[model samples]
Target: MAATVEYDVMMAPEEPERSEEEREREAETCKEKGNVFYAQKDYNEAYNYYTKAIDWSQKNASYYGNRAATLMMLAKYREALEDAQQSVRLDDTFVKGHHREGKCHLLLGNAMAATRCFQKVVELETKNEQARKELKNAAAVLEYERIAEVDFEKRDFRKVVFCMDRALELAPACHRFKILKAECLALLGRYPDAQSVASDILRMDSTNADALYVRGLCLYYEDCIEKAVQFFVQALKMAPDHQKARLACRNAKALKAKKEEGNQAFKDGNFELAHRLYSEALNIDPNNIKTNAKLYCNRGTVNAKLKNVCKAIEDCTNAVKLDETYIKAYLRRAQCYTDTEQYEEAVRDYEKVYQTESTKEHKQLLKNAQLELKKSKRKDYYKILGVDKNASEDEIKKAYRKRALMHHPDRHSGATTEVQKEEEKKFKEVGEAFTILSDPKKKARYDSGQDLDEDGMNMGDFDANNIFKAFFSGPGGFSFEASGPGNFFFQFG
Candidate 1:
């Protein structure tokens, strides 16, 4: 059986065609070239080679997936998403296609879509560590964003920092996270922390306008106004359209102006000018507690110097309103009230000063004011006029008239002009006192602590000069006036 059968045994002509295998080899070669370009960061060339590989072999989902990755690297996220979708359509089981699509969505800032794609990849392959990690990162970013938004709205800057920290932990290379951290720290009044964060961001991105602007605000809060202005100016240089930087620069300049002007005025002993400048500064920055306190204190001192007793008390009251612990304001207000003859109010202010923790100088001043207030309560204006408590109305009038005649300027013609003017003022006061006590109704009203006009009306709208003339004038009778050098009296009613 083996004899003749070997005769016709000829090797079947080897099949010479391998078109599918050849195409696959060529696609793989193109794919390798694409990977090389991608590794070198030549995305355009990588994209071209990946496209060629995909065109040459439709069945290779890897080629489409790699092309999408290259597109994503070039920030052509929409196109990359389409290619990745095509790869998934070709073979839904391809893990790389799903990962690439997810990455594309992430690059496009579609966190929800990216999360869904990554989650699906994790679902399909439990051992897919990369997919699992991506899902976790995407979900953390979403949660952080949501919480941070709410925190920012509520002005809970501390919570904003905590949420952003978690986000930065998940995406350490995110520039936005760094910028947000700086802002949150600044809002929390952690100026030094915010400055450090902003500096780190600037190191990573020298032209980062938001980071520079935030750094400026941090510097401003730290009281480094000049340095803050520099940072804001730099930020404006980087981005001329940055509104925040512009506003910060303007505010910083204003603060600097106020500080300089106020310091100079204070140095020059211009207390009123200094007070106004400090007030302007406080207006620009209402939260500046020191400036507010200084302004009130300085204004109080100026009012005292100007002899505006009530105004001095009011300014000191405002100082206490701004800072209840201001011992100086309480003491100053007490002194002003004492000067204005407000003995009860002055006693109250002095009591506050006594209770306050004050320096030795302030304590001594407060003690002195309290003693003065006690003395003021016992002061008698009628006793200063040297009138007896039981003096008859006519007797009181006679005593005042005698004193006025002795000090009358016309009676001292040889005296200096200044002495004459002083005497005339004293004579006028004496006449006014006599007029108030001579009339029985006026005397009763005066004794009862009621002001009575010359016409026996209430003192409302009564002019002291008009009342004096009406009291001395009788109907159809003459009032005395020394009109010439001689002691001759001319009278007109």
Candidate 2:
């Protein structure tokens, strides 16, 4: 059997060792087949043929570049980047290799590195339109990055978002810009938009710590505190040294603890303790608008319980300013204004609440506040007469006589025109007061806070001269008039 095998081997024409030229020709053939598959959009077959070409001729830059292109088509960006780097290393003067390298770097989110590669391409072929366009795009991304940093430092989050959008248009594969845009959206109180961006990133790379942190930030601002805390914790687990994540996680935990403590204190009727805890919670993270808004509202509730109506209103106003959608804050402030008899302010707050909520309860509260405001705007007859709501008819008459004589326009004839005008106004008010209070029916309606029409029992029917004449003149047409300085005389016709 050994003899037969030796004879067969000897008889078979000796296969010549392949020359370098022959191997190169075979590699070119494989590359042509890869190109054909690529033109057919059969990326898997193209990748297989290109890989074979690289194996056949490992030193060929075109083989590496072709394989890199196929890997990019497969969405294997890191692998493509490695192959692109190898292509450029084999042939530094290859413009296609450098361009592909830049594209890979850009897709990998290394914009600065991509900019360098694109710059190399431009230097190699100054008139290469594709290379020039790519370089411009990369440079634009860097410019937007710089602008975004400045805007973010200035707290111009809207401008930051604009710049991030521009950067994203230039580098759509860049995760860094997406993260920044998501963060800015969260800062602007667009929690859903921010969450959508962060969630998309998480779908692509579940372990992306920055994406997790941004998602947590959106959830935190949306008042999903427990879910936010879980995301923050997971982000911290992934990246222990992430400063923003660390701080956010710490603040979220502290805020939860403080807020819970305040709620407990409030439930226990310890208003002062509750206020203090809520204040501490607010100080924990001023930038956390969503949490801080609730903290302000909680402190305002405590203030209301303590009968600090003005302070409560102030706190609730701050909460509404921080978050306009905070219906509870608006409702609380309206109540505080109502308690303090600030009907105008109460009406405004209630209107805002009703507009946002549109609930029957809110609508009713708004209507009640509007009614109180209308009543407040009306003339206070008792105040004009300097009499109490409980004053007897005799007492009201005495008060009216005293106030009318003091404010009569004739009595102020020697004063300035401005003083006389004011006195005339007061005199009319006093007469109107007497006209309403002297009649039991009118007084009853006024006391009941009824809206008397202009012609019924209001100032429209008031004539100061007629009221004065009726009060002073007797059956013999007796009159009381202002005479010599500060003196009064009576006469009968």
| Local distance difference test scores for all models | 0.74, 0.87
Clashes in each model (backbone N, CA, C under 3 Å)? Answer: 0, 0
Error of 1 at 91 (Å): 9.2
The residue pairs in collision within model 1 are none
> After best superposition, candidate 1 residue 300: deviation in angstroms?
10
Q: List, residue by residue over 1-493, the lDDT tens digit for candidate 1.
A: 5666445667889967659888899889999999999999999999989888987798778888999888877867678899999999898988889998887766554568889888889888989999888887788788888999998889788888998787766555556777777887886667778889888878867999999999888877666788989999999999999997898789779977986797798778887787678678767765333345656676777778767777778878877886777777777887787777677787777667667654676567666666555545532335534688678766675576457557655566679989877876665666556655666776666665443444556433334334444545767643666566544353555
Q: Where in model 2 is the C-alpha error above 4 Å? A: 1-27, 55-57, 119-129, 385-440, 453-493
**Cα lDDT, model 2, residue 467:** 84
Worst 10 residues of 2 by lDDT: 1-10
Compared with the true structure, model 1 gives a TM-score of 0.44
What TM-scores do the predictions have? Answer: 0.44, 0.80
Question: What is the Cα-based lDDT of residue 274 in candidate 2?
Answer: 95
Using TM-score as the measure, which candidate wins?
Answer: 2
